[model samples]
Target chain A: MSMLQVSGASKRFGGVIANEKISLEVPEGKIIGLIGPNGSGKTTLFNSIVGYHPLDDGSIRFEGQEISHLRVPEIARLGMLRTFQQTRIYGKMTCVQNMQISKPNRNEGLMSMFDRFPKEDLARIDHLLEFVGLYSKRNLLAGDLSFGQQKLPEFAMALMNEPKLLLLDEPTAGINPTLINGLIDRLKRANEEMGITLLVIEHNMRVIMNLAEHIYCLAHGEMLAEGKPEEIQNDQRVIDAYLGAH
Target chain B: MRNTILLVLGTIIAFAVPFMFPAYQNQFAMLWLMILFALTWDLMGGQMGYNSFGNVVFFGVGMYITAVIQRDLYFDIEEYAHVAGRIDALTPDQYLTGIFLGMGVSGIVTVLVAIILGAGILGLRGHYFAICTLGLTIAAGEIASGIDYIGAGSGIVTPVFPTELMAKGMFFYFVFMVLAVGTFLTNKWMLAGRFGLAVNAIRDDEDKAEAMGIRTKRYKTMAWATSAFFLSMAGGAAGNLFGFIDPINVAFAGATFGVWMVLMAILGGKGTIWGPVIGAAIFHITQELFWTYLFGWQRVALGAMIVGIVVFFPQGIMGFLRQHWPHLFGHKVDEQTTVEQGATKESEA
Candidate 1:
């Protein structure tokens, strides 16, 4: 059964059709890759699924409940989150504080946030910071981290939420080639060890081919192809539409 | 341990000031009230990263509400305000009852107003939010002056304390001092928890905070409402002390108290626990000195001082200290080396 389902989803932006009747599925505890050329509506579909804006038409379901009409934070509270291509982190905050603040406060009362933060949670924050190999720099301001290092904190921040599904937009973008393997390793561990379902929009062909079991290709606001990673790597039309552009 | 000592010493000095400078109760009280203004302003400006110019809306609303409630309790406010504050009305009992009840009502009303206004206005980002709030403050005074019942162009006089009450200045001075302490502690408590982190996140990046599962709108509204809640009580205290509520002069003086709040907070290190306090003290003390010695030319010199501070010390006093003595603020000098390298890499990206 799918953990997330999007069917007939459509979004338009002032005479521009960003996503038109696009549909996809994210199966539980598996890694899925979304590949497309620039302006091919991959990000737009992710935005619609995560409730960044109101979709003009169609349905999105998480655990089989319609969520297309909900706002971003509400959708996040239901255990779905997305990361940006241009990383969004509190640059002025310490890395661990970022983790603590990202812990889902959906049910935390107004006053409960003021109480002493639990000791176990603090331990968990440290564990996640170390998971991202950022334990040494945890005390430094996030603004003081290199671009690639910043993404690690952002990754750890999303992990702190313990979201069942995470949509990563270009997670491997802007990192050195040497660090790409480490990120891929962490992504797989997050899926296999931690039971997170991922639907990633990746521009890196090699990273996606290595990381994904199933892949969906989007081109010009439509799902161009859906298949196993091996099948997608050999598709003729996908080669002409997206891979050629890359 | 150092913070604890400073806290104790600060409290002792605050309590002792009225008695030590017995003749200057009014000035001492004003100092405490100004601290309230600066601290509340910092909640949005420093913590939340919404530089608002209209927080005085709460102060004015609280003043009017308290005055209207007090007068309506014993006499019709319309007639009294028109009489140009010459009434010998309201026995001490009625006056006290009205003042307390008004304050209680003002607290609730101000919170409601804040939530509604914030829900509407806080949605605007950056400069629009600042200018919109500024409009709210200036418009409030103009609108209040036009209303006949609350005093129209004429101003309402607050219930004068019965002459039997002793040490008017000292009593109000201590009252404001207690209020200032309460505001400071509440802010400190908030900063020690997720509230502080969440707000700083908003300041740093609102879009990212929302993506992290924080209900950004709710946090923004709550921050503003929190500022409104305490500010209303401080307004209540200040209103009674002022004994008059001219729409422009006392209630909504955007040029004075309204502007002072933001200026004072910025003059200290914004976005830190002790920044506003340090800033308020320096601003109040310096302005007072300027007012005394500069005389007629004070505004001219004060304007230059403001310009100088903004241009040279935009980070404020605490920011300056943090840069030079980071260890005192729990930072290692080695981190600067890492930070500079990261900044260069970031710019290249």
Candidate 2:
């Protein structure tokens, strides 16, 4: 069975229909790509899946449980999490501190919050920070980092949660070319070695084609196509709508 | 080791102040009360980034709760109203019991009010939240003034403290001191743990914090409730200390205590643990001095101070210190990277 299944998902922002009856599936342990033109409901679908907002119509089943009605933190606790196109880190906090708080222990009570964090988790946090090439910068305030470098800690932060499926929106958007391959390698290792599934939204064709096992294309709030990498690359509809434009 | 030394030194000074200057015992107590106010205010305003203008509601509510409980426990309302300070003083045991019970009940009731109020008002963000809280404070003051049971516009006098126990000023000075220290230590402990990280996360970017599974709403509510708990207790003690509980001027006192709490936090550098403590001490001492020396123009001097704080020291004294001397706060600064970054920034600009 699929790890995530979204059926008949629709979201409307008043006069604008952000997403319309979008259906998709991501089986466990697979890397899925979502590619679309801007405002084509790629993000809206991700938002709906991760429960950022309630869906007007649809069912999102994550690990065989309906999750559409849940709130963001609740959905996150259920082993699914997402990152944003524009990176968001706790600016006032050190990168290490940011990673420390992002652990998936949302159900811990107020009393437990007062308890000392396990020493083992600190080791894991450092390991993940090193994985993202941020070991040296871990002690620095996240706001002081350049815009492109901020994405690395955010990725590491999501990894700290150990989510069953990770959704990344434009992870490579702000990052420089030299770091993109390293990020891709980390994302792949997170999928294969750590056993976390990935559903990515990427505008960069090279990165998507290299990373995603299967690709879904969206256009004007509708699912335009879904195929393997070469098939998606060759699809006429994808070319005319998105790829050709680029 | 250094922190421990400072803590011990601070405690000794706190205990010695009332005996050293007997005449300024009331002023010293007010100092502690001001510290309590700033600390509680910062829990929401500085830590959680919820700038509530209505925390004074809890303060006023606590004052009324404590005074009413104290009055209702040992005295008849009709007789007490007529001769509040003049007749039927409680024994030392009764006085102690009444005040402690009043404070306990007020703290609990105020926390419940905060949870209920926070559920509604915390959903509003930014300036809307601020305005809503301001409205809540004004509305609470009006409601308190209209309630005849708690002494409407004229206000009610608290039961007089029996001289048999100790000097009123000295007794309450220690009380407020304990209250303030307890608040400070409690804040320090929580901020050292996951609670601190969670609230700071909420302050930085609430949406992302929520998405990261920090339970932003619950944390926000908890912070507000904690603030309410302490402020309410302060109110209870403050009412007895002042010997009266007037809704607007004394209990609620939005324009004075309410505004001062926020100012103190900002002036101390809101988000830091020691910021509120320093801000409260400096602001309170300065205000007292202005009251003495400036006489009728104390308000003008205060206005100038507030303006100066905002214009020259927007980040507060602590923030200014941190920027110039990061090592003081144990923040490691890479001199090489900083200079390189500065050069790049200048070149870019």
Candidate 3:
């Protein structure tokens, strides 16, 4: 069964229709790729699905419950999480601190947070830092990290609440090719090893083709095609859309 | 090691200075009060990044309430000083109530005022918030002047204490200790809590903090309230120390006090836990020395000092010291590391 279902979801901003009745299903435990050209509403769809924006018309069901009107943090608590197009790690914080902010119990009210979880959490932080390959630079401010290295902490942060479904928005936008490959491998390992579902929005066709089990193409805020990676590559509509044909 | 020893020595000197230099006791007490006031201002202004300019409102309120209770109400205590007469005249509860009433009334009034002002102005970002608060101080002064019962503009002179000088000295010391300790603990508590994290997050990026599940508005409101509580308490203590109250004393001087506190915090280190205390000490000392020695051009000299500090020590004294003496001042102080560590642990799990 689908873990997340978006039906007839539409969002418009001052005459600009960012998403036009975009409907999609994200199955549990599957890696799905969302592909679109610039301004094709991939990020908008992601935002709406994750409750960052209210739907102009229609509904979103996460874990079989309507969550269209829920606040972003409420949705996050319900085990749905999204990463940003731009890395949003705390610049002055250490690599491990970025992840700790995402801990479910950290927000368990102020009194309890103080009473419990200072020393134990600190130790857990060290372990997580090493896990993310940032143990050596754990003491360094996150802003000082290279662009590619920053994404690792960002990814780690998204997983803070141990979400079942994770959304990545252009995860490899400005990073080097080597880091891109490394990120894909890490993401794949995370999915296989931890049973986490992944939905990625990417313009990089090669990375999506390698990482996603299924691909959906969007143009002009509407779905153009959906199929397996090879099938998507060979689709006439996708080629025409890429080639600027109507 | 050297820093620890220096701090210890500083504490010893602070304790002994009043006793060794009898002529400077009043000066020392005044400076200590200023330091406490500045520290309170910095917690809300610098550490929380909310730049308040109406702290004097609470200081004035505290002073007035304390003055009214100690002089007007408690003067009856001396009138019935004969043990049997006093016992027959006033109930124990009545005396206790009067004491608490002074503190409670002052605290509540200040908090209410702060709330009204904070609700209206805390939504403003950056310098606008500061400016609005500053304007409120002037408005408050005018309003206080109109209140006849509270002695309007001419001011209310407090009755002299019947107690010995030693007792007054001890009272000042106790008050100073409470304010200093309160300021220090509150600063530490904030920096070590989720509220602190939220404030830092808000300071770094408001939109991001909201997106990250932080209720930015709620946190900001709480910060304002916390600031109001301490500020009012400090003001009440000051009122008792001075034994007087009036519109100008509470409101006009409050505005200046607010600015001075902000300056001290910025001069020491805006957000650091101990920065405000350090800034307050340095600022009060400099101001006292300059004002006492310079006579006529003291204001000009003080203004120049403020400008010089701002320009030369943008990050304040703590930041300057850290840069110049990393070995002495350095510690694991970055906020980002804790955030990253939290994030990484979740991914691994």
Candidate 4:
């Protein structure tokens, strides 16, 4: 069964239609890639899905519940988490501190946060830091990390809540190639080992092509194509919209 | 470790100084309370990055309520006479508890007012929020002045209990210590928790904090309420110490004093935990020495000091200390090497 389903979703900013009639679905444990050129409503669609921007029309269902109009934090608490394209790690805090914020719990009280976590969860946090290659730098301020390293913490923070479905926006926008490769590998491992679902929006063709099991191409606030990576690469509309094909 | 020892020593001296010195020393002790009040201002203004100019509103409410209960209503000679005749000898300490109780009541009332006002004004950013709070302070002062039950502008005159002078002094001392510890703990909580991280992120960039799933408005309101609670308690304690209260001291001058507190916060180091305390101590000492010695030119001296601090030490005394003596006082300076490198890379990219 699909972990997330979007149907006839639309958003308007003033007079401009940032997203119009956009729909997609992601099965549990699958890696789905969302691609589009600049001004193609990729970020807007992500924002709409994450509840940052209110949908003007249609609905989004996460785990079979309508979440189109929920507040951002409320949506996040319900096991749907998103990372910004630009790094949003807390600069003053350590990387471990950032990850601790993402850990999910039924208790929202201050006393609960102060209560010691179970041994296994503590290990999971440490393991995730190691997974992101930031275990050594856990004590350092997140602002101290390199751009690629910073991106790793953003991913780590989103996973802290142990969300079943993750949305990543431009996960490799400004990182070096080596770090990008590491991110791709870790993301794949997370999907495979944890059985988590992912919807990623990216401009980097190499990262997207390697990671996505299914691909959706958007342009001019509309879906241009949806299929396997090979089919998307072959589609004339996608090639023209994304790569400005000859 | 050495810095921690120094802090402990400083606290001991603060507690002991009032007793060892003459009655005039109590004036200096009063100044320390002012410094504590200023530190509370910094908790909201500097550390939280909200520029508030109306902290005096809470302070004024604290004073007025304390005065009414201690002088005009409960502790008044006539009221006490009735109780004294009915109940056997009530000690002065028991009577002063009435005053402390008044302070607690006023503190709570001020918290409620602050929460409501904060809910509306704390959501505003920059100068708009500052100006709105300032307006509220002025309006509250005006309204308080007209309330005759609290003695109006004539103010309430607390009866002098010569036998209870020692008790009153100790009471103020205890009050000051409680407020100082409360302020420190609250500030520590804010700086150490996830909430503190969210606040810092919002200070750096509000939109970014929102995108990261932080409820910025809720955090701001909580900061404001917390600030108001402590600020009012300090004000109430000040009223009890003075043994009299008027609108000028409780409200009007309090508003101006709030500005001074903000200045001290900035001069100490805006976001650093101990920065405000350092700033408040230095500012209060200088203000006291100058006002005591320089007389009429004290304001001029204060203005000059503000100018000097702004021009010479833009990051304030804590920033200056961090730059020049990272290891001087035995405190570990947080090296921003990573942040510096990240900024450089961003610029290069």
Candidate 5:
């Protein structure tokens, strides 16, 4: 069974249709790639799948349960989480504190409000911090980190939750070329070692082709083509989307 | 350890001050109230990044509820409304019971109201939320003014404190001091926990916070409700101490008490535990000095102070201190080696 299934998802902003009749599936424990030109509604699909905004039409199922109507937090609790294109760490808080807040439990009750961070969670947090090469700066305010450095903590924060599936939007958008390889390794490690299924939206051909087993290409708010990385690389339609067809 | 010593010393000083002057007991009481105001305001405005201009609505509701509860408890409601605060038949025991019971009920009811208001109003973001809350306060004041049961237009009068108990100022001084301390400790404890982290996350980037599994609206509403709970109790005490509850001026008092709370939080360096406490003290003391020496020009002086705070200390005193002396607040000034090490690690990885 697929970990996540999106069927006939459509979204619009006034006169502009951001996504229309988009269908996709991520089988449990597989890294899937989504590639699209600018304005092809890749981000919009991520937003709708994660319940940032309601889709005008369609259904989303996660682990065999319908989730199109669930809000963001609710969707997150059911083992689906997403990271932003623009890194969004709590700038004023220390990196450790950021990790603590991203723990699985929403802690929605009055009693949970007063909960101290558990000692066990600290060990896991530290491990994740080390995994992302940020243990040395654990106490530093997240905002103080360089733009590339900030993304490391954000990735670690998502890992801290141990979500069944993680949605990464442009995970390597602003990273240095050297760091991109490290991030790709970590993403693969997270999949192989920790069993986190990934759905990544990437513009970098080299990164997505390296990271994703199967790639889906979107153009003009519709699914243009999808296949194995080499097939997608050679697809004439995708080539046309990237470099306008004659 | 040093903090505990300082806190004990501060408590001792707080308890002794009204006794030292005796005459300025009410002024001392107002000082505690101001501290409460700043502390509570920072919970939503500073920690959660929901700047509300209508928190005074909860305060006003608390005042009215307490007064109504007190009046209706012992005496006839119809007769009490007509007499309007002149009747002082209750003994010291009755007075104390009424105050405590009324304030408790006021806190609870106001929290419920806050939750209801927050559910709808907290959905609005940023300035729209702020403006909506301001409208809520103004509308509450106008509605209160129009109601006859609570003394429309003219305002209601709270029962007079029986002198046999103690001087009213000294009584309220202790009461408000306890209230302020409770507010401080409660806020400090809450902010030390997951609640604090969650709210701060919301403040930093609400959309990101939500995507990370925080129910942003829920946390926002909870913070507002907590602020309301404290403000309502303070309002109850204040109404009885002042002996009047003019809907616009005293109960709601959006133009003065409402504005002052926000200013005090901003002036002290919001988003820190000690910031609001320090801010309230400085702002209150400065206002008192201006009121005494500046005479009729006090408002003008206050206006100037507000401008000065905005211009020179936009981040407030704590923020200024944090910026200048990071070590004092436990922030380490990192050596250049760390950044270099980070770059090396990136390349190596």
Candidate 6:
């Protein structure tokens, strides 16, 4: 059974059709790729799947449960989370504090908020920061970090929640080309060693080919192709419509 | 060691203020009330990032509730209010017991009111929240005036304090002081924990905080209710001290107290624990001194002082001090890296 199943997902921003009958699936513990040209509905699909906005027509089943109607925080609590194309880190907070605040605890109460945070929480946050190669700058304000560096903490923050299915929206977008391989390795390790499943959105074809086993391509708010990485690379329509456009 | 001594010395001086200047007992009590208002307002404004223009609503409701409860607890409130200006004086015991019981119940009732109101209102963002709260305060004042049981237009006088036990001002002075300290300590405690992180997260980017699975509404509503609880108690204290509950003037003095609360927080520096405290102290002292001593030149000096603070120290006194003395607060300075970054940005541009 697939970890996530989206069928007939549709989203419309008034006059703009952001996603039209978009559908995809991610099996448990696999690293998958979503690729498209700009305005091709890949990010829109990610948004709809994570419950960022209500889908106009769709069913999103996570762990075989329908989740299309749920809100972001509820889906997050259900062990699914997503990062943004434009990083959404707390700028004023330290990178470590950002990592800490991003942690999802099921215990919800007013008085409980005052209890001392467990020491192990900080240790885990530091460990993740080290994994992201940001341990030295953990105490620095997140806003002070370079764009690529900010993305590292943003990814680590999603890990803080310990989500089962993680969505990466252009994770390596602004990163230096030389450092892209390192991020890809860390992401691949997160899937293999941490037992996390990843559904990634990427524009860089070479990077996705190197990272994702199976790739789905979208163009003009509709799924254009779905294939193995080499097959996607060879598909004439995928290249002419997307790779050639880039 | 030096910080501890200063803390001890500050506490001693605070407790001794009424004794040092007997005539200023009422002024001192009012000062503490101002501090209480600032502290409560900052819980949402500074901490939770919701600037409410109508927190005065809680204070106003608290005043009327406390007064009415005190009157009704032993005697007929309707009869007492109808009699107007002349109360069948309570025996000293009844007055003390009634006052304490009234305040306690009012605090609880006010908190409940805030939670319900917050559930409905905290969802509004930015100016909408501010405007909704402003509308609430206005509507409450109008509603309070129409009700005859609490004295409609002319206003109702409260049960007179027992002047025989001690100076009326001193009794109220100590009452307000305790309330002020309680509010401050409560705020300090909440802001020192995970609650503080949640609050700052809401303030920075509420959407991200929500994405992190924080029920932003829950935290916001809780912060508001906590703020309402203290503000209402402070209102109850003010009503007792002033000996009257005029719907618009004393109880719901939104124009004066409402604006002052936000101003004090901003002036002292919003978001920090000490900003509101220092702002209220500086503002209250300056306003009182100008109004009393400077008399004819009061308005000019008051305006000038506010303008000076706003323009010169926009971040508030605490923020200004933090920049110059980061080491004092244990903040590591990184000016060299910052300057290099700035130069690199210039070249990039």
Most lDDT-accurate candidate:
5
Measured with DockQ on alpha carbons, how good is candidate 4? 0.14
Pull out the clashing pairs in model 4. A102-A160, A102-A161, A103-A160, A144-B338
Give the i-RMS of model 3 in Å.
5.8
Every model's TM-score? 0.93, 0.95, 0.83, 0.85, 0.95, 0.92
The predicted structure with the larger TM-score, 3 or 6, is 6
Question: Against the unseen true structure, what C-alpha lDDT does each candidate score?
Answer: 0.85, 0.89, 0.73, 0.75, 0.90, 0.85
lDDT score for candidate 1 against the true structure: 0.85
Please write out the lDDT profile of model 3 over residues B57-168, one tens digit for every residue.
Answer: 7777776775567545645433423431222343445443554467667777777877777778877878887888788778778888887666778766544433433455
Better of 2 and 3 by DockQ: 2
Could you tell me the TM-score of chain A in candidate 5?
0.98
Q: Model 1: residues >4 Å from true position, as ranges?
A: A243-246, B1-5, B78-92, B324-327, B331-349
Query: Candidate 5: which stretches are off by over 4 Å?
Result: A106-110, B81-88, B333-349
For model 5 chain B, where is the 10-residue window of minimal lDDT?
B333-342
- Candidate 6's error at B173, in angstroms? 1.3
Q: Between candidates 4 and 6, name the one with more favorable TM-score.
A: 6
What iRMS does model 4 reach? 6.5
**lDDT per residue (tens digit) for residues A1-246 in model 6:** 999999999999999988888888899988899998898888889888888889999799999999999998898889998898999898767786788788785666667777656888987886787788776677677877898888998999999999999999999998998789899899998999899999999988878998898899899898889989999889999888864553
Clashing pairs in 2: none
- Of the pair 2 and 6, which is ahead by lDDT? 2
- Considering the two chains of model 1, state its CAPRI-style docking category: acceptable
- Please report, as a residue range, the 10-residue window in candidate 6 chain B with the lowest summed lDDT: B333-342
Evaluated on chain A only, model 6 obtains a TM-score of: 0.95
Q: Candidates' DockQ values?
A: 0.38, 0.40, 0.18, 0.14, 0.48, 0.35
In the predicted model 6, the residue pairs found to clash are none
Which has the better lDDT: candidate 1, or candidate 5? 5
